[model samples]
Target: MPTGVAIRDVREQLFDAAERVLLRDGRNALTSRAVTTEAGCAKGVLHRHFADFDAFLTDFVLDRIGRIDARTGALRGSAGTGTVADNLTAALTALFESAAVAIVGLITARDELRARLRRDLPAGVPVLTEAAELVAAYLVEERDLGRITADADVDTLAAMLIGTAHLLFADRFGTPPEAEGVRRIVTTVLVGVGPRP
Candidate 1:
């Protein structure tokens, strides 16, 4: 909102405020006014940066997806440092802890926003698919290091992990699975994939 401030900085601030509102008060509470008020900016600031509320929402969700993808990508560097199951649990845990789950409902509730995202993003795959690919790549790295079995189906394993993360994060009544629970899920899935003793 301030003069001479970078647009990226302003957008980041708005995004952070929006995420806080969504996480604290749920998806319905996320409004331009709410985000601006939380960000300490003028009510018009959101509209100034985005064409409309739907656009802002689309951007916000996409931003979160980007972050999730980046986190999965970073898992490559940690390939052999920890137990493969532990490393995967850590990645899945990070995805669960993100605002992705909270915003997913918001995106799905509005068809227009969802359509807009599909239009803006590449036609091939959604962000979650890309995330799955990242996980598969990490699994491959582990297999190459002899951490996991060579015959493991990394693609199927990646999809299973992503689905598990979605289920764990989407739980409304119960607390989401913690790191230990995630580790358990990963270990269970890797029963055939992990190296034999």
Candidate 2:
């Protein structure tokens, strides 16, 4: 609130604040004021860093999407070491437990934010698309390793996995599905596409 006060990692702070607002109040309540208030920074801090509120939001979602890289490495790294269903369940749980679902909701409900993000992200839902890509990459690794069937379409399977997980975790505000519930869905979806017992 003070004039000329330096905030470290201002962009990241604003993104985190925005995510918290999205999780707490849903899509309609995310605003520049809300984010600034949550971040404990003056409203001008956001404008000083980003061109506008929508720009801030677009970058916010992209930042969240970018954060998925750690998950990708971890998920891909787990390919042959663990059961495919369990790995998927864990990935889905981590993704939704973060702001992924609420970020998707914000992306869908805001036209300006969507349009701005389209130039950079360009296809599929931003957070979901990145998640699906990683899922596809992980599946391809498994398929190559014989954990998945040779005939399986990794891309389609990835989409199905991400989509199903998204639905299972959607509309719950901040509460994620029970781990068992997520695992059950993951197991059901992986059936027949996995190696023959």
Candidate 3:
């Protein structure tokens, strides 16, 4: 809206505004008008940067997924330092954050956005698949460090973690799982996979 605003700044502001609207008012309330109003910018700003509302939604959803990936990807750095349960809990918690869950709902509720994402993303897996791979990679690194049992099926463990988190996030009306709960889930799931004490 400002006369001298940078394009990147505008896009970031729009994204932030859209996220706020989606989180506060649910997926149905996310529109170019709502985003622009929240961002204090012209409605055309979204269209200027994205092809349509679906494109904007796709970018917003992908951005959230990218953030989750980056967060989980960093777990590799903490691979052997902390208890495997603690580290895995941290990654799973990051995946189920309120905003991330909200974006998941937004994308799922909009067929156009989902379709666009499928077309744009590689292998039709979207970023969630990449996130699982990142988690699996972290598990492999921990195994290499002898923190986890070498026999652990890292891919299966990663999928189980992702699937559980997805269920937790999708059930919005239920009491959300806390960090300790996540720790318990990870501990239970890793019983056979963790190194013998």
Candidate 4:
């Protein structure tokens, strides 16, 4: 029925609007009424899709992580195809860019959501660890292929890149890191660990 279609459309709109509210205002503003208002729907619409606020919040957090994972997968396909530093910078930047604000908001509210995220969601740690490990493997491969300096400590350098990304995320939300700011950090890490050419 046309009414059914309209209701489905409105539900989709509400879900998206909730994400925007979470991103902009953090967890404090993610009430059911707020989401419905943002979606221009009545309060009851939220319960039609989601059972409760906690369920909605749980799904929202997982959805955000899934989005970032998909973005990383896309970036990986194009990685190592360009100049090493350029590709590495692009890959790493893609990992952190849009998710920075959301991540910062989540981290700042970790005390409230940490236990729930831990219990309900698979921690993103494995994916993050895998990413860093792949970076190390790539460095070792490049060195073996004579594309990079032989002396670089691949794992250490990979860890440094990952650690620096965390710092950059913090800086981005707290102080609004500039283009030059990110470039400086990336270039510094690459210069120390990347190929001489």
Candidate 5:
């Protein structure tokens, strides 16, 4: 005797509750019982919508990434013309800022979930190497437009930026000062290649 309206309402409530649990308690606290209690639904409600916890976690990560991407896209038109170093630093900083919560979610995901993420990452997921290549292309474009110094090696500088961001945000080394880290990245990359004084 499950009404369609009731089922849909329950599903939405459960999902919203699950999101709160994730934000508040991290991955370790994500359980069907927790979600059910938060949603004020029977525990079986979660299983009805999601095959398992892993599937729920996967969907959560993908949804967060989509939200972050949308926020980053909002900054596109207003990105001012600047030296390659300046533009790249602004872009990276904005991306990180917009993505902080999602980044925290990724950081706190459980080992099993992390392993699943590694195995199930979408083909289009931007890894460091691919990101560096894309950045290198952008640098080449910037150089041709005379926004970057003539001596800059676009590939190397892009690789350095990618590597630095990965270290700051990915691996465990304690969080770096956001502004200072961005400045250091720009300075290190632009030191030899920037316009001569």
Candidate 6:
């Protein structure tokens, strides 16, 4: 590999490469060499940016979690406008469509990564936990706008949605579950919460 080629935005490049490797090869296949190879940079490039392989993986997981944080604003903005089911369907679809499930798989597969993440996270699985938090935040917005029931347990509901969505998206060889299929799951979970107002 060429040693002198300049790679702009090396951190993002490595993150993207790691995500692709995680999604395509699963976590066990992810390694410093594989990531650097996929990113078209020297393995030393990864080390220079992160302390170690697990550090890279920890930041990689946090980076994806930060992405879920980024989506919260737009999702919250949709609070009262669309049908609750529609809003939720879109949100959950967007969450899983990214390398979320793959990242979750990566975290689960790496004990060291999980330990590093615990310093900041401390509870629940990293990606899925934040996914549920964002969903819960959106549900709170909807409830405030009267789109969801006043009595609805938004936190539990959000947790349930994330769990169910994880199951639906988990283990797919490649093709994601259809949007319609996702919508049905969303609607079913929201059913007992009361009709959308």
C-alpha positional error of residue 10 in candidate 6 after TM-score superposition, expressed in Å: 1.1
Model 6 lDDT per residue over 41-95, tens place? 9989999899999999898889888886676447777887878888888888888
**Colliding residue pairs in candidate 3:** none
Q: What TM-score would every model get versus the actual structure?
A: 0.86, 0.94, 0.88, 0.69, 0.60, 0.93
Please give the lDDT score at residue 25 for candidate 4. Answer: 75
TM-score, prediction 1: 0.86
Candidate 6 local accuracy as lDDT?
Answer: 0.86
What is the TM-score of candidate 2? 0.94
Best by TM-score: 2
For model 6 the TM-score comes to 0.93
Candidate with the larger TM-score of 4 and 6: 6
Clashing pairs in 1: none
lDDT of 3 by residue, 1-197 (tens): 67667556777788889888887788889889999999997787778899988888888877877777777766888887868888888887877774767776776677888788887675534555766788899999999989888888999998888777777666655678878878877888788886777
lDDT of each: 0.81, 0.86, 0.79, 0.64, 0.61, 0.86
Worst 10 residues of 1 by lDDT: 122-131
Q: How do the residues 1-47 of candidate 4 rate in per-residue lDDT, one tens digit apiece?
A: 22344665664577688777766776677788888888777777678
Per-residue C-alpha lDDT of model 2 across residues 60-160, encoded as one tens digit per residue: 88888878667555898898987999898898888877788888888889898888888998598888888989999999999999998999888988898
| Quality of model 3 by C-alpha lDDT | 0.79
Candidate 2: worst 10 consecutive residues by lDDT? Answer: 64-73
Worst 10 residues of 6 by lDDT: 68-77
Q: Judge candidate 4 against the unseen true structure and give its global Cα lDDT, from 0 to 1.
A: 0.64
Where is model 5 poorest over a 10-residue stretch in terms of lDDT? 71-80
- In model 6, the runs with Cα more than 4 Å from the true position are 71-73, 195-197
Better of 2 and 5 by lDDT: 2
